[model samples]
Target: MSDVRVHNFSISLDGFATGAGQAPDAPFGHAGERLHEWMFATRFWHEMGGGRGGSGGTDNAFAAMHGPGVGAEIMGAGKFGPPGWQDDPAYKGAWGADPPFHTPVFVLTHRPRPSIEMEGGTTFHFLDASPAEALKRAREAAGGQDVRLGGGPSVIRDFLAEGLVDHMHVVQVPIVLGRGVRLWDGLESLEETYDIEAVSAPSGVTHLTFTAKSR
Candidate 1:
């Protein structure tokens, strides 16, 4: 059976997945790269950046889980681009021509667009569908592999609310954004449905993994 998973999604100490005032120039808004600095120091991230210098520690181990077994991805519109990106017809996405996700990616948006085929086997399919509907499409596209719930907060929240996610990995960065798009809003007592484990990384960030308990 294919499972829905979220890997290495970062959140601030204040619970903001992304900072306020997000724009083309500042993708993560005022929060900047503070939320992802820990990942940047990982060997997995360094390799993604076309470099060969980074730590091979806990962070890298968790970051590397993002790939294997994932066949397709479902992400929010915000994860695909900055604010107002949908308005731009020429938007190639935040990852440029060669995205790290070398699989089918379904972006949830109000305005749907033609599918984009990028380098390294990545194809972006824009869809305006509910969480269940979108997951269905992604699962089909994934063939027999698991579908990854690539998020920018809202998407993950929606899936979690619907009790659709099977495994989730979140990295809690040690910074307080004060204000931004929060990941846990309205999601009271989420731990009740899942077996949650927390591990602190040497980088001061806590790696939280959630596995859905059998019903």
Candidate 2:
């Protein structure tokens, strides 16, 4: 069965998706990277880079839940934002030599940009279309496989509030952003119906999986 999943999505104790002053200078933000410290020790993460000999523990189990994905992903423009790329014709893509995502990645953006093709079966498609359109295109490209919503808070909340996202995995970290970007800022209405299927992980991070249909 085709499944749309948000795997290993990190969040802070205060519900912040990212820390203050987030920009190109800080990839994960000032203190935002702290949210994903749980995943850093996972064997799955290590294996993704072709590394070996990892500790199998709670963090590993938490990371393992993301699985084994489907085929495609949808992300917001914030994931890769840069004014320089818009001008330089020589600029290929944000991802360096070999990015982990070896599949079709649809980036939601209003400004039109040329489609970027990369090695390892990855292609960056800038979608001027709405979020629904992008997800539809991604689902078709998935070919019956699952489509993941690789988000930047706003995107994920939009999908959830719109009931477009089928399933999601929210992994909460012990840290607090204090004052920053939040995951479910204005989507409190979603809390009434969206049901959490499971909540597990002996690791420091709390893993919560939710399904919209369960409502």
Candidate 3:
């Protein structure tokens, strides 16, 4: 069976994944790009830009795992764009023409839209289904490979709450957003479900992994 996983999902020291007031100008809101500074310094990030010059250490190794073995992705509407993105008929998504996800990307929204074929292998498919239903569709699209849970906090939390995620990697950036969408909200004693591992990197970020225990 293909596993459902999350990789390089950054959260603040306060457990917030994104700041409040996400608008067209401020995607990360008051938090800005602070939460993802560690990833931005990694070679994996630069290489995605079709360039060189990025660090190659623990952070890079972790960032590198974001792509491989992922045949399809399921993300929230918020991660697809800012507020009112569906309103705009011409919205191309947050990553523009060529998104990093070179697979079938399923966006979970109340209002489903037409599929979008980008420059890369990414083809956006909008759906208004529950976590299990969406995961089923994505797994079929994955063609026997793993399905990635591309999140924006709330989405991740929902899947986690439903016990749909098999593996998860969270990068804890050293910052306190105080207010915003939190990852750990309503998830108490999560260590019981998954064996958690913590590795602190040189960039002041802590890499956390949660692998579900065998049933």
lDDT per residue as tens, model 1, 119-199: 999999999999999999999999999999999899999999999999999999988899889999888999999999999
| Segments of candidate 2 deviating more than 4 angstroms | 67-69, 82-89, 197-202
Please rank every candidate by lDDT, starting with the best: 3, 1, 2
Alpha-carbon deviation at 93 in model 3, angstroms: 0.6
> Mind giving the per-residue lDDT tens digits that candidate 3 earns over 80-105?
99999999987989987899999999
Stretches of candidate 1 off by over 4 Å are: none
Total clashing pairs in model 3: 0
Q: What is the lDDT of residue 174 in candidate 3?
A: 91
Could you tell which candidate, 1 or 2, scores higher by TM-score? 1
- Candidate 2 lDDT for residue 102: 80
**TM-score for candidate 2, residues paired by index:** 0.89
lDDT (Cα atoms) of all candidates against the true structure: 0.94, 0.76, 0.94
Q: Which candidate leads in TM-score?
A: 3
